[model samples]
Target chain A: MEKIKEVVINNSEDVILARQAAREMARETGFGLADQTRITTAVSELSRNIYLYAGTGRVIIRALSKNLKKGMEIVAEDRGPGIPDVEMALQNGYSTNRSLGQGLPGTKRLMDEFEIKSEVGVGTTVTIRKWL
Target chain B: MDKVPILKMGDTLILAIQVELHDKMAIRLQEDILKEIHDTGARGLVIDVSALEVVDSFMGRVLSDTASMAGIMGVETALVGIRPEIAITLQEMGLELKGVHFALNLEKGMELLQNIGEIFYGED
Candidate 1:
């Protein structure tokens, strides 16, 4: 994997920046408009989750290749209060806040591969990828 | 943060969102639209998102909430110009965006609002 960029998600505006950066990278990677939209939407959800839940986080975009498959990877990491129940967090409509609670599950649906790691009071990290 | 420009035409208001809207800007737009409707007594709203590349869950929620709010204020609303890709993505993300009308483009959106108006008030 090769790093493309890292967008910090501190304020609400950073969520937009993170998604825009993902869109540009996806476009440059030759993904069609549908795929690009998917990538950007997934990034938007993840980055917003970071902003809403963690208050601050980092989204790192990376280019990955193995054999003939090439893909884009996004890693959202936050050092805020970690989710104690990761399973519950991944479920739809389970938001503690007033949000719609579609962030994690919807992001998983948009990407080809998804992974999440977190520890209570330790923080959380979510990684997702879409292949070309 | 550029505000989405709202144009008043007769009894209707049209909002064209040209810039990639941030969260704050989107909320600001909702407030602005409500204010405009209140000040002008507009009966219809058409939101054109043709230039937008993506409408994520947050944006979708804002649009839905704005539509509901406008409905409470007696303004019929229509969302127009959702790109094909965005339409599909919004569906896959489980954002039904119910209660708000939809059309292919701005002209059609206006027509929808007109039809809705005729439904509420007898067509003359």
Candidate 2:
């Protein structure tokens, strides 16, 4: 069965719900254990980033496959001040926020595939993929 | 998230961690804890994680790696109070933490350490 989950995060508290959305979808889709964990970790990192940088956002999880090898796509979007330098943001240990810089780069490293798009004054959207 | 602190009892060092152990804080925390173990020259290192709700692959790997690093520094490390939910997530994530000892709570962890050390200072 195809499943799609969407959750809007307006505060740090919303991050948990966003993560649950991804976790529940992964579990329901019959993905492998590692794939499920990877999805949950990715969601947690991105959701935390949204709260820290944009102060709000939405996490979208969509199951893309149904056969022996299943896959899912996660997209996190926010309407806030976007990153001026995407390259710098991808670098590990480089963070605009005061906390340790591990959110975006770590999230990218955890998933099987990752992509990001951001425009200054527009917003930022991060997409991650994992296959079972 | 509350910051974890280091406790010293005689020659033993106990570090209580009560927050989400993720990438951003892992390096700094590792350096600090290792340095404390080295400087104090403690026989046992106890990590309390009852307050932690989740343990991801990143954090789990770091903990296991730190355990090996502690051995080289002559300190035995023990993990205390890992919640069942955290265990389920770690298993679901296919994360393996090798060589780090664990206990259900801080008190039991201390008892195990005392037995290993052959000190047996009961009733704390």
Candidate 3:
């Protein structure tokens, strides 16, 4: 895996920047238009989550290759209050902030691989990948 | 500060969103459109998103909310020019943007709003 760029998710503008960065990286990785949209949407959701829940965070975009399959990876890390229940958080319609409640699950569905780690009072990190 | 321009045309209002909409900008648009509807007494709203390359969940929600708010104010809202890729991505994300009218282009959107006006105002 090779790092592409890092975007800070401190405000709404950062969320858009993160999405743009992800879309550009995905395009460079040879993703189709639809796939690029999917990746960008996923990044937007995660970055918004970081801004809403964590108050501040960073999104790391990376290019990955394994077995000749190229993909784009995104990692969202935040030091805000971590989710207490990862399972519930991953479930659809489980947002504590009264949003559409589709951020985590929807993002998971958009990407090829999804992983999340969180500890209450510590922080949360969400990683996702989409292959070309 | 970037803002979406809302233009008034007769009894209709047209909003062309040409910039990347951040969260604040989206919220501001909703507020501004509603205010315009009230000030102009416009019964129709046409929102052109043709230039927007990406429509994420946040933006989708804002659009939906804006439509609902317009509906509450007796304004018929028609969203136009959603690219094919955005439609597919929105569908896959499970955001159908229900309750909002759609059109292929600005002309069609205006025609739809005219029809809506006839339906509500019994035609001129």
Candidate 4:
């Protein structure tokens, strides 16, 4: 695995940057247009989560290769009020504040592999992967 | 600092989104659309997204909400030029994009808008 880029999410503008970075990396990692779009859109949702819930966080995109398959990975970490229940938070139609509950599960569906870890007061980290 | 341009063509408003719209800008565009409708008495709206490469959940919600809000204000909205890939993504995300009409292109969008607007503005 090699690190591609890291975008610090401070506001809405950073969200756009993160998406663009993800798209570029996805294309370079050998994803087609639709998969590139999926990767970029997933990054968009997760980056916005950082801005909306955590206020500040970072998204690191990485390139991965295992055996003969090439893939891309995204890691989003935030030091905000974390989720008390990961299962419920990942469930569709579960949300807080202004969200319509599409952030977590929606991103999960867009990516091939999804993992999330959150502690009530500690923070939250979400990792997603897509292979080509 | 970026604003989405909304063009008024008689009884309808046509706006094509060509820039990378951040979250704040999306919200701003929604408000601007409504304000334009209020000021011009436009009964129909056509939003072209042919230039947008991606439509995430946030942008999906923004579009849905914009259509809902415009529906309440008696302005029928027709969203046009949604790329096939974007439609696939939105469906995968479970965004139904309710309360708005979908058209293939700007011409189709305008026709759909006028068709719906007949109920709202035909008396005039």
Candidate 5:
């Protein structure tokens, strides 16, 4: 079992940066391109959500290898006005964003594992995992 | 989003689309446009995605499919004015939209439309 390493980034644009970093790490750690793409898409959705909906946040990326397989975990946390209705937010075709409502549900569909925790006026935390 | 009608060469029609191309609305729009293409038998379609900031894979795939569907129905599709940043992101993510045309600006897109004749001309 390999050790878990963590990286944290702040700033809205850093969402893409964090995804790039995670993709590189995932590749070096033995993940395939499909896994890499899925992870990045998931990251893009969450990171964009944090930037657009919440205004600011930090993306914490953790890399781990276990049982001869590589695994990556990403945690995106924001301290802005949280989602008032998480259930509705996760539903397809639902978006507070005027652009496309695909962000949240799209993220859910792309990840190997996904979890979201949020409270109104508090904050939002989304955790995603993928194994390669 | 503003919708505008475009005329070219005194005989062709190009509908200008300006809005977000997401999953929710993309299908209905695609179907409506396909029907319009069949009805008007227009020469081209100009989708202005400049105002759009984000595009997911599913939406990208749908657009690509719509372009092909239009081709079978005797209409050509052109995607004009995508931001450089968005283009880079789409390319990095491997979103290669097939059967569609792209231009840096709408003027250039309209210029490209000049070469593609009316849809009926290509029908036979």
Candidate 6:
């Protein structure tokens, strides 16, 4: 795996930046137009969650390869008030902010693989990948 | 402050979003469009997102909200130029954007708006 870009999500503008970076990286990683849109949308949801909950965070995009298979990876990390109930947060329509509660689960559906780790008062990290 | 320009074309307001819309920009656009509708008494609005390659849930909500707001003000809103990929992703994410009208392109969107205006206010 090779890290291609790192975007600091401190505000709304950073979220757009992160989306653009992820889109570009996904393009370079040989994803089709639909896949590129999927990757970018996932990045937007995760980055917005960071700005909303953590106030600040970072998104890391990477290119991964194993044998002949290639994939793109996105890692979002935040050091804010972490989620107390990870399972509940992943469920549909479980928003804490009156939203549609589609951020985490939607991102999970867009990517091929999803993993989340969180601790109350510690932080949270979500990693996702899509293989080509 | 990034602002998406809203142009008035007769009884219609045209907003062409050519850049990636952030949360603040989306909210600002919503406010600006609503104010324009109030100030000009526009009967129709056309939002062209043809240049936007991706749209997330927040942007989707903004579009939906803007459409509903315009509807409440007696204005018909048409969303135009959503790429196929964006449509697929929005569907997969469960952001159906219900109660909103869509057009294949800007010309069709303008035509749809004109038809909606006629249906709402009767033909002049």
**Tens-digit per-residue lDDT, B1-124, candidate 1:** 3867799987899989998888889999999999999999999999999999988777888899999999999999999999999988987877768669999999999888898899998786
The segments of candidate 3 whose C-alpha lies over 4 angstroms from its true place after superposition are: A1-3
- The DockQ value obtained for model 2 is 0.12
Candidate DockQ values, in order, are 0.73, 0.12, 0.68, 0.78, 0.08, 0.74
Per-residue lDDT of model 6, residues A1-132, tens digit only: 475899999999999899999989988989999999999999999999999999999999998898999989999999989999999998877788735688888888999999999998989999999999
Counting clashing residue pairs in each candidate, in order, gives 0, 0, 0, 0, 0, 0
Encode model 1's per-residue lDDT on A17-126: one tens digit a residue: 89889989998888999999999999988888888888998999988887999889999999989898989988888788746777778888889999999987878999
Candidate 5, number of clashes: 0
CA lDDT scores, all candidates in order? 0.89, 0.75, 0.89, 0.90, 0.68, 0.90
Error of 2 at B78 (Å): 5.5
Check candidate 6 and list the clashing pairs. none
lDDT of 5 at A106: 67
**Candidate 1, B59: how far from true, in Å?**
0.8
lDDT per residue (tens digit) for residues B1-124 in model 2 = 5346889987667877765554546667878888898788887888887776556544676688778788788777788988776676555444567878788887888777777767544445
Q: For model 3, what is the alpha-carbon lDDT of residue A75? A: 93
| Candidate 4 chain B: worst-modelled 10 consecutive residues by lDDT | B115-124
Over the stretch B1-124, how does candidate 6's per-residue lDDT look in tens digits? 3788889888999989988877888888899999999999998899999999888888888899889998999888889999999989998988868557899998899999898778878999
The better candidate by DockQ, 1 or 3, is 1
Model 6 RMSD vs true structure = 1.5
State TM-scores per candidate.
Answer: 0.96, 0.61, 0.96, 0.96, 0.56, 0.95
List, in the given order, the native-contact fraction of each candidate. Answer: 0.68, 0.04, 0.60, 0.68, 0.02, 0.77
Docking class of 2: incorrect
Candidate 4 residue-wise lDDT, A56-125, digit = tens: 9999999999899999989999999998888988888898867678778989999999999998778899
The segments of candidate 4 whose C-alpha lies over 4 angstroms from its true place after superposition are: A1-3, B119-124
Between candidates 2 and 6, the one scoring higher on TM-score is 6
